[model samples]
Target: MSKKLRNHDEVVFEQLLNPEMAKAYLDVALEEYEQDGDLGFFLEALRNVVEARSGMTSLAEKTGLNRQNLYRVLSPEGNPELRTISLILHHLGYRLSVQPIQS
Candidate 1:
Protein backbone atom coordinates (compact mmCIF):
# COMPACT_ATOMS: atom_id res chain seq x y z
CA MET A 1 0.00 0.00 0.00
CA SER A 2 1.12 3.49 -0.76
CA LYS A 3 1.70 5.83 2.17
CA LYS A 4 -0.13 9.09 2.29
CA LEU A 5 1.89 12.27 2.62
CA ARG A 6 0.77 14.94 5.04
CA ASN A 7 0.62 18.58 4.05
CA HIS A 8 3.69 20.55 5.13
CA ASP A 9 1.67 23.04 7.13
CA GLU A 10 -0.20 20.24 8.88
CA VAL A 11 3.00 18.51 9.83
CA VAL A 12 4.52 21.73 11.19
CA PHE A 13 1.38 22.53 13.19
CA GLU A 14 1.32 19.03 14.61
CA GLN A 15 4.92 19.28 15.81
CA LEU A 16 4.35 22.78 17.15
CA LEU A 17 1.48 21.49 19.30
CA ASN A 18 4.16 20.24 21.67
CA PRO A 19 5.06 23.15 23.94
CA GLU A 20 8.74 22.29 24.07
CA MET A 21 8.99 21.96 20.34
CA ALA A 22 7.12 25.19 19.89
CA LYS A 23 9.48 26.99 22.24
CA ALA A 24 12.54 25.67 20.46
CA TYR A 25 11.12 26.60 17.12
CA LEU A 26 10.36 30.11 18.25
CA ASP A 27 13.80 30.47 19.73
CA VAL A 28 15.42 29.50 16.48
CA ALA A 29 13.18 31.90 14.63
CA LEU A 30 14.13 34.68 16.98
CA GLU A 31 17.80 33.94 16.44
CA GLU A 32 17.33 34.03 12.72
CA TYR A 33 15.61 37.38 13.02
CA GLU A 34 18.51 38.75 15.03
CA GLN A 35 20.96 37.54 12.45
CA ASP A 36 19.03 38.69 9.42
CA GLY A 37 16.91 41.53 10.76
CA ASP A 38 13.93 40.14 8.93
CA LEU A 39 10.92 41.06 11.00
CA GLY A 40 8.58 39.38 8.54
CA PHE A 41 10.18 36.01 9.11
CA PHE A 42 9.89 36.42 12.85
CA LEU A 43 6.27 37.46 12.59
CA GLU A 44 5.48 34.51 10.38
CA ALA A 45 7.13 32.19 12.84
CA LEU A 46 5.08 33.64 15.68
CA ARG A 47 1.95 33.28 13.60
CA ASN A 48 2.75 29.65 12.98
CA VAL A 49 3.07 29.02 16.69
CA VAL A 50 -0.18 30.82 17.33
CA GLU A 51 -1.91 28.72 14.71
CA ALA A 52 -0.42 25.54 16.12
CA ARG A 53 -1.42 26.27 19.69
CA SER A 54 -5.12 26.84 18.92
CA GLY A 55 -5.58 29.47 16.25
CA MET A 56 -6.23 33.18 16.54
CA THR A 57 -9.70 32.86 18.06
CA SER A 58 -8.47 31.09 21.19
CA LEU A 59 -5.47 33.40 21.53
CA ALA A 60 -7.70 36.41 21.09
CA GLU A 61 -9.87 35.20 23.94
CA LYS A 62 -6.90 34.55 26.20
CA THR A 63 -5.21 37.87 25.38
CA GLY A 64 -8.44 39.88 25.29
CA LEU A 65 -7.48 41.08 21.81
CA ASN A 66 -9.62 41.34 18.75
CA ARG A 67 -9.19 38.31 16.51
CA GLN A 68 -8.81 40.47 13.44
CA ASN A 69 -6.22 42.60 15.19
CA LEU A 70 -4.19 39.55 16.06
CA TYR A 71 -4.28 38.49 12.43
CA ARG A 72 -3.13 41.89 11.30
CA VAL A 73 -0.42 42.09 13.94
CA LEU A 74 0.93 38.70 12.96
CA SER A 75 0.72 39.32 9.28
CA PRO A 76 3.96 39.63 7.31
CA GLU A 77 3.64 43.39 7.05
CA GLY A 78 2.44 43.77 10.60
CA ASN A 79 4.47 45.84 13.04
CA PRO A 80 3.40 44.94 16.55
CA GLU A 81 4.04 47.05 19.61
CA LEU A 82 6.28 45.76 22.39
CA ARG A 83 3.38 45.46 24.82
CA THR A 84 1.31 43.61 22.28
CA ILE A 85 4.10 41.17 21.58
CA SER A 86 4.60 40.58 25.29
CA LEU A 87 0.89 40.04 25.77
CA ILE A 88 0.78 37.50 22.98
CA LEU A 89 3.79 35.63 24.30
CA HIS A 90 2.42 35.67 27.84
CA HIS A 91 -0.77 34.02 26.75
CA LEU A 92 1.23 31.55 24.71
CA GLY A 93 3.07 30.35 27.81
CA TYR A 94 6.24 32.16 26.89
CA ARG A 95 7.94 35.47 27.58
CA LEU A 96 10.70 37.64 26.19
CA SER A 97 14.03 37.95 27.95
CA VAL A 98 17.21 39.79 27.24
CA GLN A 99 20.69 38.31 27.28
CA PRO A 100 24.07 39.96 26.94
CA ILE A 101 25.97 39.27 23.76
CA GLN A 102 29.12 37.24 24.30
CA SER A 103 32.22 39.15 23.33
Candidate 2:
Protein backbone atom coordinates (compact mmCIF):
# COMPACT_ATOMS: atom_id res chain seq x y z
CA MET A 1 0.00 0.00 0.00
CA SER A 2 1.18 3.50 -0.73
CA LYS A 3 1.94 5.77 2.15
CA LYS A 4 -0.25 8.19 0.29
CA LEU A 5 -3.18 5.81 0.34
CA ARG A 6 -2.62 4.28 3.75
CA ASN A 7 -1.54 7.29 5.76
CA HIS A 8 -3.09 10.11 3.83
CA ASP A 9 -6.68 9.19 3.11
CA GLU A 10 -7.80 12.47 4.56
CA VAL A 11 -5.41 14.29 2.31
CA VAL A 12 -6.26 11.97 -0.53
CA PHE A 13 -9.97 12.55 -0.04
CA GLU A 14 -9.46 16.26 0.13
CA GLN A 15 -7.37 16.15 -3.01
CA LEU A 16 -7.86 13.03 -5.09
CA LEU A 17 -11.06 11.22 -4.16
CA ASN A 18 -11.37 7.43 -4.54
CA PRO A 19 -10.58 6.40 -8.12
CA GLU A 20 -7.77 8.86 -8.58
CA MET A 21 -6.25 7.72 -5.32
CA ALA A 22 -6.31 4.16 -6.58
CA LYS A 23 -4.37 5.16 -9.67
CA ALA A 24 -1.87 7.18 -7.65
CA TYR A 25 -1.37 4.26 -5.32
CA LEU A 26 -0.84 1.99 -8.28
CA ASP A 27 1.83 4.39 -9.47
CA VAL A 28 3.58 3.57 -6.25
CA ALA A 29 3.29 -0.09 -7.13
CA LEU A 30 4.94 0.67 -10.43
CA GLU A 31 8.13 1.50 -8.57
CA GLU A 32 8.51 -2.08 -7.47
CA TYR A 33 8.48 -3.10 -11.13
CA GLU A 34 10.85 -0.44 -12.46
CA GLN A 35 14.11 -2.02 -11.35
CA ASP A 36 13.65 -4.66 -14.02
CA GLY A 37 11.29 -3.00 -16.47
CA ASP A 38 8.69 -5.48 -15.39
CA LEU A 39 5.33 -4.37 -16.70
CA GLY A 40 2.94 -6.02 -14.28
CA PHE A 41 1.85 -3.04 -12.26
CA PHE A 42 2.11 -0.62 -15.13
CA LEU A 43 0.08 -2.91 -17.32
CA GLU A 44 -2.50 -3.49 -14.64
CA ALA A 45 -2.96 0.20 -13.95
CA LEU A 46 -3.18 1.09 -17.61
CA ARG A 47 -5.64 -1.73 -18.20
CA ASN A 48 -8.03 -0.36 -15.62
CA VAL A 49 -7.89 3.20 -16.91
CA VAL A 50 -8.02 2.11 -20.54
CA GLU A 51 -10.97 -0.16 -19.93
CA ALA A 52 -12.70 2.57 -18.02
CA ARG A 53 -12.19 5.56 -20.29
CA SER A 54 -11.41 4.17 -23.75
CA GLY A 55 -9.63 1.57 -25.81
CA MET A 56 -6.23 1.39 -27.53
CA THR A 57 -7.44 3.20 -30.66
CA SER A 58 -8.36 6.32 -28.73
CA LEU A 59 -5.30 6.18 -26.51
CA ALA A 60 -3.05 5.54 -29.51
CA GLU A 61 -4.55 8.47 -31.34
CA LYS A 62 -3.69 10.66 -28.42
CA THR A 63 -0.18 9.19 -28.01
CA GLY A 64 0.57 9.23 -31.77
CA LEU A 65 1.15 5.46 -31.88
CA ASN A 66 -0.20 3.39 -34.68
CA ARG A 67 -3.37 1.68 -33.54
CA GLN A 68 -2.11 -1.84 -34.24
CA ASN A 69 1.23 -1.30 -32.49
CA LEU A 70 -0.45 0.43 -29.60
CA TYR A 71 -2.75 -2.51 -29.23
CA ARG A 72 0.24 -4.86 -29.04
CA VAL A 73 2.17 -2.82 -26.51
CA LEU A 74 -0.78 -1.94 -24.34
CA SER A 75 -2.14 -5.43 -24.29
CA PRO A 76 -1.96 -6.94 -20.82
CA GLU A 77 0.60 -9.47 -21.98
CA GLY A 78 2.81 -6.99 -23.82
CA ASN A 79 6.04 -5.35 -22.75
CA PRO A 80 6.02 -1.67 -23.65
CA GLU A 81 9.39 -0.27 -24.59
CA LEU A 82 10.68 2.82 -22.81
CA ARG A 83 9.77 5.06 -25.75
CA THR A 84 6.26 3.73 -25.83
CA ILE A 85 6.06 4.16 -22.09
CA SER A 86 7.20 7.73 -22.44
CA LEU A 87 4.58 8.45 -25.04
CA ILE A 88 1.90 6.84 -22.92
CA LEU A 89 2.96 8.89 -19.94
CA HIS A 90 2.58 12.05 -21.99
CA HIS A 91 -0.74 10.99 -23.40
CA LEU A 92 -2.06 10.18 -19.95
CA GLY A 93 -0.68 13.33 -18.37
CA TYR A 94 1.17 11.18 -15.87
CA ARG A 95 4.73 11.70 -14.80
CA LEU A 96 7.59 9.50 -15.94
CA SER A 97 7.49 6.95 -13.16
CA VAL A 98 10.33 7.91 -10.84
CA GLN A 99 11.52 6.95 -7.39
CA PRO A 100 13.18 8.75 -4.51
CA ILE A 101 16.31 7.46 -2.80
CA GLN A 102 15.97 6.63 0.84
CA SER A 103 17.87 8.95 3.10
- Top of the candidates by TM-score: 1
Backbone clash pairs for candidate 2 read none
Write model 1 residue lDDT over 1-103, tens digit each, in one string: 9999999999999999999999899888888889988787788989999998889999998889999999999988999999999998888899999979877
Models, CA RMSD each: 1.2, 8.3
Residue lDDT tens for model 2, 5-76: 455434443443345665676566576666766777667666555544556778877877788877677666
The deviation in Å at residue 86 for candidate 1 is 0.8
Per-candidate local distance difference test: 0.91, 0.64
Over 4 Å off in model 2, which ranges?
A: 1-19, 32-37
Q: Which portions of model 1 show Cα errors greater than 4 Å?
A: none
Candidate 1 pairs with clashing backbones:
none
TM-score of 1: 0.92
lDDT of 2: 0.64
